[model samples]
Target: MPSVMEMKPLATFFVSHGSPRTLVDETPTTEFYKKIGEYARREGIQGIVWMAAHWETPYDTIEVSSNPNPDKDFVAFVPDEILDWYRSYKINSSPALADRCCGMLKDAGFNASLNSTAIWHQDVMIPLRWMYPDSSTCPPMSLISVNGRFDPYFHLKVGQTLRSLRKEKILLIGTGGGIHNLYTLSWHHIIYYKDTTPRTKPIENFAAAFRESMNESVVRNEGGPGLGRAMCRLLKHPHFLKCNPTPEHFLPMVYAAGGCTSYEDEGSVNAFGGENWEMNTQLNSNFVFGLPKDDTIFLGEGS
Candidate 1:
């Protein structure tokens, strides 16, 4: 097999893993991930470098493990069915790639270190489990921690530091809710919403307005750039706290954004999961920064 260093650069993704309930459904979002996996195989991703918002340590960290399995935390929050689905997945990790990532980050001047820890957040496990289906088939995976500080500039800088790994075909995936604030949305929307048919609640509304603003900010086009503006509006957004009670969920975007080829590098924006967290705050939205094999396709799956 060709080593990761031998392969070409792979794209980075901003994956939205909404409530755990969505994992069992066969939805567009889930199909989007399957196609993404197919795309990754075509690109020869040596291993996965997953940067998750759910896992945060004071210092930048990476997990080194061979044949890893995801840890199901907070299983009691959901139904037995959800827990059963979560328990069915066994994702693998890569120790070699973890070491390489640590070396690269340290050389790049970031406070990087390695641990033999079993770190699996819903953000990391749910998407991959649904996307790959078969755990062993996954490439060697390494876990990267979100910094304690939710500074966009800092995370972006951290992403920039790891850009070199792309040459090794290491995939950088940022997993968390783009509009992640479970506290605001109605529980009925979350617990009751099924994957098929028209959603009981409209995809738009107060939740969508914020998602729209986020959409405009990230998707580059003739309308011009919005990263600068988006960053500014985030704090200003009336539901900013409701959308993001804490920084862990939203910080990954800054890191993902920082790692893109350029601010102008075009990506796709996907808005789903209408379950409003608080005051019409929707835990929806995801983006990707990379060259798509199909120019017409956004993140290998069009919105």
Candidate 2:
């Protein structure tokens, strides 16, 4: 068998893991999640390094969730039954990978710490349950906390530090929405609308502007550092605040973009299909970067 480092490189993904309910909701976003799961299985993924919007720590340090079986941190405002159901989902973690991740971050001058008892948040579990439904057979995984200070570039550097993991067939996934404004969400629409059809209509005004800007930056044929820098600039975008009332959700995408810094081809960064708008407040435009050239067909699956 080929050595782990000798294995063909796999892509890094930026997934917009919608709501906690997405686990049960059969929306377009969930469909894409299933497709990505197929893509990962076909690619022979061995491990996962998940950067979750829900797992944010202080700016001075980064925490790597090291628990062998991390517990779920239930989301608020949901029905009690849903929370009970969510508790049943579990993830088998990779302690070796977690330690390796911590060492790598520290070597890169980051204040990396190991979190032996971190709680798994919806941002991490929702997409995992959808993509890798069988937790028992799912790849060994671990979570990396985003900087609580919500510094885009800081997260980018963190991604850059872990870029080498892709060569080992370990998927790096950053789960956060492209457009997340809970205050603006259509609560009534979400409650009354039962149709599972994916929202494909083009978003207007500030949402459109922000999404376009993000796509342009990601597709630019540049090094990891350049892409990371380009993505960091979005924090200053006029529509940024409108799209992301809080920085947590938006910061993970920067980490995803930063992970792509290792690839230089114009097509290194490709958007996944199934762009969906939820409650007119969340936009799920997922991306896969550093894909092998021969696997262009996989690109057709999402973008």
> Of the candidates shown, which would achieve the greatest lDDT relative to the real structure?
2
Every model's TM-score: 0.77, 0.88
lDDT (tens digit, per residue) of candidate 1 on 126-166: 78866676766888788778864545666776667777677
Instruction: Please identify model 2 stretches exceeding 4 Å from their true place.
Output: 1-6, 75-85, 191-204, 220-224, 263-267
Residues 105-199, model 2: lDDT tens digits:
99999989999999888887778777876677688888899875857778888888888888788888898888888987766554665332345
Candidate achieving the largest TM-score: 2
RMSD of each candidate? 4.8, 3.0
**How does each model score on lDDT?**
0.61, 0.77
* Model 1 whole-model lDDT (C-alpha atoms): 0.61
lDDT of 2 at 79: 58
Candidate 1 wrong stretches, greater than 4 Å: 1-8, 59-70, 74-85, 188-206, 221-239, 262-280, 292-302
Clash list (residue pairs), candidate 1: 184-277, 184-278, 185-276, 185-277, 185-278
